[model samples]
Target: MQLRSALVTGAGRRIGREIAIALAQGGADVVLHAHTSSGDETRRAVQQHGRRAWVIRGDLSSRRNVQRIAREALEKTGKIDILINNAAVFFPTPISALTAQEWHTFRQTNISAPFFLSVLIGRQMYQQGQGKIIFLGDWSGRRPSRNFLPYCVSKAGVSALTQALAKAFAPHVQVNEVAPGPVLLPEDYGPEQQEELRTRTPLQRFGSPYDIARTVRFLVESGDFVTGASYVVDGGWLAQGHDGSGTSL
Candidate 1:
């Protein structure tokens, strides 16, 4: 089999890094996209797996930038067998304090950019006859969040977009989503918050970035028959339910 090629956005850190590296380990040449010029470690890690890794930096909030990154990925890798829409912006925005600017910013990065990029890549994949497109979603989309309203809504849009695209691009390209919950904590989160999240999960533990990455790999490598679906890798967070005590299984 010919080695596959993949384009993963926001692959410079955290979950994106894990997905990119996992794809490389699975014998896929990767086009790793980052917003800032800071992915040397990720690039090195991918290269260590004996796979070609190309770094492309662009702000996904802009349609032009999204197109540019997609074009460059195709140009650099010659073919894109998989596309992981892993780039996103998450911030707190209570309903009372939500601003138009915040809504636009969140939607631009989390929804619009990924939607357009998927359309563009789906077109290319349609021409090629086979491909996989995976969107990184969130558990909050299933369970709404008051503090992260914009972020949650944008992710909900992603879930809907995945199903829509799967129907639209059927028999040629597969479209699916991976929704994670508390897999990786943000830098500002304290230890108490982390423990609270783990307690809420049925597994009683937080998921690792690699947990989501491995699930993405399975979807790409073996999910050709699967589409218009979502796999929640939340350590049973959604299945357990989020009771006020943070302990419900």
Candidate 2:
């Protein structure tokens, strides 16, 4: 199916921003959402590609907001050909100090939000009889992270959700996942930590947001027969059997 429009969440910066722009370059109008940030720049970039760009600012953690996301996106562009469930909150939640609030936050943002978005949007795609849904998961999801207990559990749920949704929306909506690692360093990551992480990866290098963006494009633009797969773009980190599974440097 030709991609006429895409809804990208958390697209104010980093991977989400790149994905939004890449989709625009691929000739799809974009609707970008962010919880606390502005997607004005991303919208401008998408608009620069001669495609319409709509910005929606709301917290995915809110069920009301999640319910309205696909509705607003479809209202803007009339149809949503690509649904990128990319909004997630990542943090370290050691089992020892894991709090109920922290776990709630992780599950709400990382799991529930995406699930709601997919159900609402997937039904639309099914009705149209053609569409693609790409969930942004985590590399730690495949291999559990020692320091990110809640996050790992949440992301693992996403992996399962991908497979379940793929089956539920079969023959119409192709559901897949992109699990990225070391794509962008955190603001608090130090140089020593960065170097250590770089050496641990089999690729000996971190990934760029565009790297993930390219992967997302391939999933939407091609891969018609592919679904229920979690594609990890982690510089071979997981394959190397590396002990560094935490989402930080």
Q: What is every candidate's alpha-carbon RMSD to the true fold? A: 2.2, 1.3
Q: 75-125 in candidate 2: lDDT tens per residue?
A: 888888899999888766777988999989998998999899889888988
Each candidate: how many clashes?
0, 0
In model 1, the Cα lDDT at residue 15 comes to 96
Screening candidate 1 with a backbone cut-off below 3 angstroms (N, C-alpha, C), the clashing residue pairs are none
Top candidate when judged by lDDT against the true structure:
2
* CA lDDT of every candidate: 0.88, 0.88
Looking at model 1, residue 43 earns an lDDT score of: 91
Model 2 clash pairs are: none
lDDT of 1 by residue, 159-181 (tens): 99999999999989999999998
lDDT (0-100) at residue 5 of candidate 1?
A: 93
